[model samples]
Target: MSDEGHWFYCLKHMRVEYGPGCPNKDRMGPYDTEDRAKHALEHARERNEAWDAEDADQGS
Candidate 1:
């Protein structure tokens, strides 16, 4: 469960990186693949939609 060799999407620069390029708070990470990191925004939106649907299903 370590962060070594992981990829990250830097929100500040809007790019993907594989090392300690930006602050953790300003990036989304630990993605196993660079492709996933590259589509971070899309992945986030997909997760958000799934959560929103679940919330609607729960009536909350």
Candidate 2:
């Protein structure tokens, strides 16, 4: 698959960027779509919540 012109959500800058503007460690991903990249933070929050709930359930 061609990786040219990928989209990423920069955690450090809190913005969407095309191609490699920031380091991978500080970015969300080379998302398939720009819209998906834009929702990176929301997805992260959902995953975090799910993980937290799982942890609580395991603890109990």
Candidate 3:
């Protein structure tokens, strides 16, 4: 790919086509290179977990 920071979206659900009514669709990065994309994906996972935990605690 010519673009170094090509966006790769997260697909949390098995079959949810992202958008309204779909599950998680929050973007976490514009990571550069394939290796960075992997890292960014990991970051996204961690970020989501932390965010969810914080929200859960807040809701309690």
Candidate 4:
């Protein structure tokens, strides 16, 4: 996606940034909205939990 209107969660600054704030390695995403970018850590945790559950289910 284009980086013009996207938002990102800046890991280094711990804040929501609008359009190309920090380097990609120190940020969460090009989320469509600022609110989504703000919740990046929560989203990541939820996804990780879901993936872990899926892995466990597959193993079982």
The Cα RMSD in angstroms, rounded to one decimal, for candidate 2 relative to the true structure is 1.9
The digit string of per-residue lDDT tens for model 3 on 1-27 reads: 222335333444322122233223444
What lDDT would each prediction earn against the true structure?
0.90, 0.88, 0.48, 0.91
Q: What are the per-residue Cα lDDT tens digits for candidate 2 across 1-60?
A: 334678899999999888868778898888978999999999999999999999999999
Where does the lowest 10-residue lDDT sum fall in candidate 1? 1-10
The positional error of residue 55 in candidate 1, measured at the CA in angstroms, is: 0.7
**Estimated TM-score for each candidate:** 0.86, 0.84, 0.43, 0.89
Which scores higher on lDDT, 2 or 3?
2
Per-residue CA lDDT of candidate 4, range 10-34, in tens? 9999999998667889998989898
What are the per-model numbers of colliding residue pairs? 0, 0, 0, 0
Candidate whose TM-score is highest? 4
Regions of model 1 farther than 4 Å from truth: 1-4
Kindly indicate the candidate among 1 and 2 with the higher lDDT. Answer: 1
- Residue pairs in collision within model 4: none
Candidate 2 residue pairs in backbone clash = none
Worst ten in a row by lDDT for model 3: 14-23
TM-score rank order:
4, 1, 2, 3
Candidate 1 at 47: error in angstroms? 0.8
